[model samples]
Target: MNIEVNSQNLKFLECFASDTRIKIIELLNERPMNIKDLAESLGFSSAIVTKHVQKLEEAFIITTESVPSTRGRQKICHLTLESATLQFRAKKQDDQNRYAVSIPIGQYSAYDVKPTCGLASDTKIIGMVDDPRYFSDPEHVKACHLWFGSGFIEYRIPNYLVGKQSVRSLSISLEICSEAPHYNENWPSDLTFYINDTCLGAWTCPGDFGAVKGVYTPSWWKLGTQHGLLKQITVDSEGSYIDGIRISDRTVQDLAIHYGDDIRFRISAPETAAHSGGLSMFGKQFGNYDQDIQVYVAY
Candidate 1:
């Protein structure tokens, strides 16, 4: 039921335009059901239902997995989209198009200390393990990566849209994931992002993201722990989006980020979150993206 109702990406809305597909979604929403059962419940032939299921699956509105059945296998389908909102437009004609800045992962202006925290470059740890003093060490500036079980890392940057009349959008992209003492693929962390003081949204990183050699992980680094996921989050006048998918209703105005202010970006796993999964952040030299903490602004 939760959807980004946007004016763009018209093709993404095609699957929902059919009556048969609507019924398919309804059935799958209630419970995952195979095409045969869905066809029977909707009073359609199996061939017809199968076709509709294929379309829904392609649109990413539904997902399918094959399971053992008398005939060898049955495809079980489930709805993936909750709902969506319309994206009104791209940057306006007269508006400033885009601005961006890349900050080193360890260059945070302020940070609260917590155990299980450490800073590292692609080659080696900056100092002793779990040491807060190292966070402020001159060597910290050279760090391309770091992690912590809790607490926030805050960076101050210049706002690019001060005194502008056009609607503005802000985005900060970094590679990150849940933290474990070592690597655990099953760990899940609800990491929240903030712009100035507004809570933009939280993305549940599914694991510690280690266990294999990351695409750019140093050869000196050992295996058993992978790198973080490359996530580009956009917060605009309409809402917040992760990898181009809208996640919340908080808009750019809600962020109250002014062009004249020393804009702040903070990331943390709050104690009140459903999962205290901790955090592991990667830098341009360490993760798949080979990029630093990137800030993007657009009209």
Candidate 2:
């Protein structure tokens, strides 16, 4: 996803690029610290450390929280962004043309998930559940299945465009649907969306729409029996999107998008739901496509 770096962002990034400032960030990354503790850890004068931290705070790269210190009240500084990528302007060449690039999440070697899940490309499935024990049983492994209680799926996105100059925006797309039997638009499911551990937004999928069946859904499965329905989740600055269209007015700034070495995308439901109420997730099972998630970036 692309974000316009105005004077504010540029200033914050520049301040964070410094050795002393980055050291300060690394120190605070674990927990917030006051100027005195920070200066002592870095062997710098408290005045000098304060001056550098002020720059970061003014740019919104760091934040302060007042707490009781042995010496009285102290203001602790903390890093705001979870991760960041340093984007530079592109080099001028004989050809002045804009290019659109797509990188599959599968190409990245680093990724993790909890409980039970799987990842696959058009070519083959990777990670757990690839064996016939799980795949052989259709009911055991649905491409995308949802439950009433809490469940989560996570993806690790490597900083693919590190050191690149000027990114216009970043866009993430995925096909999602209910994992219950039958369609009912009236049923509301509490679905949460997150990126890099930041809450992007939450959406409740309305009753299932049987008219539009998933491409990979089997006809014998019966209408709304195994999979309620499928739709898309597209999010950017403008707002949260579904099926390539805007569904929420929330923008990218609301989610605090950042450039970093690794980005994490996660979605989950709480265990409070007593029943599925006809909601299911179709990630690897019963879908025509292999990798149901797609992330696009514009620079």
Candidate 3:
């Protein structure tokens, strides 16, 4: 996340002013917690913790959801923003040499999935849950969220390079995580990436997060994965990177992409992987980030 030094962003800056909120952020960094848990840990009353939580939520630093509990419904809180950058100066505005494409999560051209798989749109589930056949349903194209126990999904993206345009780097950003029954914070999945057919290596997502509802997740979505970590995978002339850390030696040149070429991207969590935990993808209306599979090409 990026923030500018302006009055419009004062609320976000103010979130860090209080020591109580700072402590709340610290505890949430370890794991998601409810208001009662936070209160107990901070030696404060639930009402005080709730007030602090409201402030954090308003700042878009955290998310909360009410879920069933032994007593009744309790509000669980989850940390949302992983990191933020405070920009002190303006940078050059240049976008002519670059182009971006946003592919809906459900617009995959090919797929092979196992049970515990399903798709959902912003309004409703497309078909029966845990049914792989539904992946081929016509309504699949409108899905904003998708998951499977194992296997792969493939998307064919258009290469927008015009005459004389080449490539510098390709960055694909999406919201993804491991898939488990309902939710789990510790399930790890080794999700591999392939461009065209070349392997760009794999990333291990930590878990299926449902500790709290996603900020944009519909209220009707209950008892399931609520959110995922926003990850950016970039392939440059040097190598492939997840977020900003190098993940493999695969380079953009290796893709051999050209004008009018087809960019077939694949995400797989094969059963043969060490973790084999499964995969889940969240789209604009389902995850914290209001975006689909964002593909940015710098030429």
lDDT of 2 by residue, 19-102 (tens): 999899889877778899999999999999999998888765666767797788987786644333333553233222223333
Once superposed on the true structure, which residue ranges of model 2 sit more than 4 Å away at CA?
1-148, 164-167, 181-186, 208-214, 219-232, 237-260, 273-279, 283-291
Against the true structure, candidate 1 reaches a TM-score of 0.67
Error of 1 at 15 (Å): 21
lDDT of 1 by residue, 1-299 (tens): 12355554445677878998888888887777988899899999999999888888776566677779988999888664444445445345333477778999888898886767788887888887688778888888888778887888898976656566443778777888888777897889899988887887888988886654455667776534557776777887779988777788999888776556787888987766798888888887786557888887776
lDDT of 3 by residue, 1-299 (tens): 45677798988899999999999999999988999999999999999999999999998899887889999999989889876667668333369988899999999999999978999999999889998999999999999999999999999888888897788888898999999999998999999999988999888988898876788889899857998888888898899988667789999999978888879999999999999999999998997888899998888
Better by lDDT, candidate 3 or 2: 3
For candidate 3, the TM-score is 0.81
Candidate with maximal lDDT? 3
Q: Which ranges of candidate 1 are over 4 A from the true structure?
A: 1-96, 162-167
| Candidate models: Cα lDDT each | 0.76, 0.52, 0.89
Q: Could you give the candidate ranking by TM-score, starting with the highest? A: 3, 1, 2
